[model samples]
Target chain A: MSVEPLNNELINNELIKYESIGISFGNRKVLSGFNLTVKKNQKILLRGKSGVGKTTLLKMLLGFTKPSEGTLYFRNRVIDSKTCWEARKEIAYVVQDTDLGEGKVKNLLGEIFSYRANKEKLDSEKLWTFMRELELEDNILEKNFQELSGGEKQRVGILIALLLNRNIYLLDEATSALDAKLKKKVADYFLAREDWTLLIVSHDKEWERDWMRIIDLETQSW
Target chain B: MPIYDISYTSLIFCFFLLIIPIFISRKIRLELEKSTLEAVFRMSIQLFFAGLFLNFIFNLNNGLLNLAWVGLMIFFASYTAIKSADLNVKKLFLPIIISIAFSNLVILLYVNKFVINLENLLDARYLIPIAGMLLGNALRGNVVGIGDFYNDIKRNENRYLYSLSIGAGRYEAVIPYLRKSLRAAIKPTLANIYSIGIVSLPGMMTGQILGGASPLIAIKYQITIMVAIYVSTLLSTTLSILTSFGTAFDDYGLVNKELYEKSS
Candidate 1:
């Protein structure tokens, strides 16, 4: 019947959508009238100048920042205070500055894994594999997180995202401190996963790929 | 033996001791002369009133009146704690007042009943001063605990949000900060416990000795009071932080920014 196709179309696969989004600090409008739609397994690299609200856009999905105007949707449901908490459980967010407080890296990771939703997610075998792939030595986990080099700290953020095993990734300048080779390796690692949805805000050119869809906020219509 | 009282002339001699500190402040350019004089003046006036008020309360010794005075102390203790912690006093006052009252009253009665074995349990001499000591210590603990907890979360907000994003419930994410703040709050009390007898004679023990009690009895009282102070401080600080959680954080688990007093 004709109704079957219509119902199939209505079963929307859009995982995240931002409609007419606007953000302002005081009188300055950092972002205005922006729109974006991300389908399942979509890889989006948001490109914009510094202070253009790319990070704010990513944080809006997690309810860290509220939009001054318009609506944001996750799985076709409006992302409010309640739904945002549920959305956070499914998204792995790697902040630009990874400050895990004053503690040994091992203990910090243990604390994260101890969360109810994150329980039993700490796979030591997978941790070692990711550490080796990220070029982090075994002894690095013993060092204080605050004392690690910028690149090491950034990788730690990335490592946490990987360890979370969530499908949706929000990377805000996550690889800025890494070298070119590691950047490409990290980019490739994330891009190779066809089932993962990535919303990346990075300035590195290594993330540019043939299959990736880039949204340049500077040039996009407001 | 009878307790000796300082005469008005002897108290004047006590006021004269300030001249030495005033001279030292002047020589060292510590700029404390005015504050030193003002502090001495204020202490004299405040203690003068407190002595008179306490004298009247002790003579009456009505159970209700003694409890009422303790209640007033708890109210002021809560007010000063929030104000000193640099939080919005109006927002935090209710929870803090309740917490201070609950923790101090429970410990105070427990000490009076079980330790001292007081039949009246509301004797002004035992109740008011013990309440003062417990409330005073708990007030300091709450200031350090509540202030550090909120400030730490605000300062390390990204780390907190990272935990939240990784599927941490609000309580789970805050547990780290809670552990840290509680430790900081109790550390001073712990240090005092360790250094109490050797480094200094605590005020209560000194008072008892001055009031013609044996050193042995004074030490016993000092030990008991120190233990009581430590336990009540921990209780109040923990309770203050836990009770304020509902108001201090929004529904999204983010700290309520308005609860923080704007830095002037």
Candidate 2:
């Protein structure tokens, strides 16, 4: 009974594992033999120069891009096309480009909430609160998403990620467009959540918290 | 009053009209002389053969032969739609053919049975021509709809991937794209329906009037045919998009890269 409980604890703590991951674009191998393990509630900030496959790593976790070599695991289960969908359910991903089409913000939000996994998660009160927290105006939701400024679009993307209420977050340049103050505020808000696992890819200084483990892709062994 | 056929001499005079466009092309450097002549020549030869074949089929009026001809039309329609949309014909052909055939048949049979009250449902006179109209519209719609859908997804891949990463299922993520493409597919049909008599007299109604039908009878057929064409176009476009979900997307719900024909 004691041994079983310890094994369960260990298994439960390890949220994600990248076993010797490699990514290649054609003949050029951008990333190779990279490995990382993420524990539950761990905050990891991935730093890399452009084209180092930082974004590719995040996408691989969602099965958007498959690793050229090695395997990825989520919650101790191998992340294949089949299991990645389930993994996506528990992960909130804020993409680098926040182009959600030309629809009105409210309609787009409604469409997102209408998904089967997100059906009951849309709370109007929370939406308003988050919007306010994110410095979004009341009339912003009525405006066309494409008409919004880059900062506003980024905030909206972050707002969506927060509203999803998922434990794991893959934030790719999620705050690049935000002003310094808003960026710090957003980073603080995300960092305050001790139980949230964050995999952030950004060049922002605001995300550099003492508790966050920073991994530089360039310095890592290929 | 019998409908007057174009005499060979008058047809030659009609061909003379092409010289004006050829002259304009040369003046404006449009460089379309070769293509224009080839298109006209191809249309004449194809339609000449079609007229002969259609006449033979009408005389026989066998239900099985008419269905086989309709099947052949569907096959060519599907092939053209895929080719026009720049999709791999081998991958998407089966689903597209099935969708076009199903939608056209359903609307055609319903029109024959309930609207026209035809004694012979598969009579070549009705089946072949009606099928041609329905299949033509559906083919155009499918080209627009399927092409827009896959192209939109490809262009805005980040948005689509964002949805998937946020816990959306394949259908959920694709619903927005589907809605947009379906609207695009049916927009022309809707415009044609609204602007029918006001903008131009439709070919079917004009043909019927020229063939000695009363204006009132031609207008009635025009209305029914317009409604039938609209319904079949919408149905086929919707079914084509849905059915293509099987082959166009892989197990990961990502569009198969191989589904697109590589541009030379």
Candidate 3:
């Protein structure tokens, strides 16, 4: 508990580790004895069917859900409410449901970037460029988020996560609603960031590239 | 001039007026007759006993006993607020009680000591009636405030998690919700304040006027009580929602599902 966070000078390799994590909803077992180790800059895809707890796994990183069984570690330390707070600063999680906020898209993004940790990281230029890459019109930012198209909302969710300037990401079906070409485009954009570690949960085949490690959670039955 | 007391015969004539609403409900198929009757009967019994008991308490006017009566009011207010919201009272009782009691008591004392300038702050006439006005409004505020807050959080849970994942502290993540609920809570009170004289004569003003006070004095009491109700409500509803945070969520900042009463 007294251990100080490791200095930035050292080689900080380990990113996240799930050691024997398990959870159950009533008597039904969802995930049990789940184990995984994620290292820095290692792009990984988590593949599983619906309701099999793939999203739950990503949520664990942000302390959105607690494991009924084991410990989750970030940077060689156990993840808890406190650690998740710090980890969320460096980790961008784009939920499957991009009903991320209400009101204007620009305002939503503005609020997110207004947090103390992300205050300096709000770059309008970068946001516009990302929007342009995602084929989102400038007017979309002025539009109400609840009124946006599903694909447009997905892109916005991904766009905000990318703009957070974080090195780690957890994307839960983050690109599912996009069309084929746009899926490839979005997948390519994330993959191009070599230093960014990604834990992606998607049924879309666009992300099934050779370079990214795919962990089919179905096979492991975590 | 003093008001005339209604004889039992006059009161019976008043009961005859209830037939209009009952007949209208039956004619229009409004299905409100049973509820209307129940409400009338309940109010009649409640007020009759409350009048008798308050008369006794006013004559006695013991400080500790008066405080105990106010405590009972606070407990009932909290219970009704939580129960009306269909929440598990076990989880919310203490927080709501503490909040309502603290806010109502604080304002009640302030009104007695500072506003009314009474020598005996616990004088039953001032204390009981003033506390009732404050607690009644606070009750409405809590029902809206805490209820709206938790309901919004439950419905749009993903929105909350989205805020959390954006590197927001718990307070920061929950601020939007707090703002939203607080706005919902204060709206009725503000509207009441706004249209106090034009739209309707408030009960306090009417009661004071009928009780033989000068209209000017009645209006003054109305003004002070309105301000008191608004202040107490703001404090109580805000306090209830804030203090509920102690139990509403776990250490992870996720709302405890157990806090809500499960549907039958």
Tens-place lDDT digits, model 2, residues B233-252: 99999999999999999888
Query: Which candidate comes out best when scored by DockQ?
Result: 2
Report clashes for each candidate as comma-separated counts.
Answer: 0, 0, 0
TM-score of 1: 0.97
The iRMS of the candidates, in order, is: 0.9, 0.8, 1.3
Off by over 4 Å in 1: A1-12, B26-31
Which is the winner by lDDT between candidate 1 and candidate 2?
2
lDDT of 2 at A72: 94
The sequence of per-residue lDDT tens digits that candidate 3 reaches over residues A1-222 is 334455542336778999998877778888788898898988888887777788888888888888889999999888897788888888988876787666888888788878888888878889889999999998998899999988898899888887888889998899888899999998888888888898998888888888778887778833
Q: What tens digits encode model 1's per-residue C-alpha lDDT throughout A1-222?
A: 989987766546689999999999879998889998998888999998998999899989998888999999998889998998999899999977888888899999998898889999999999999999999999998999999999999999899899989999998989999999999999999999999999999999988887789999998743
Q: What digit string (tens of lDDT, one per residue) describes model 2 on residues A107-169? A: 999888989999899988999999999999999999999999999999999999989999999
Model 3 residue A64 distance off true place after TM-score fit, in angstroms: 1.5
DockQ of each: 0.80, 0.84, 0.69
Give the 10-residue window scoring lowest on summed lDDT in candidate 1 chain A: A5-14
TM-score of 3: 0.92
Off by over 4 Å in 3: A1-12, B21-39, B262-264
lDDT of candidate 2 at residue A59, scale 0 to 100: 93
Write model 1 residue lDDT over B61-98, tens digit each, in one string.
99999999999999999988998888888878888899
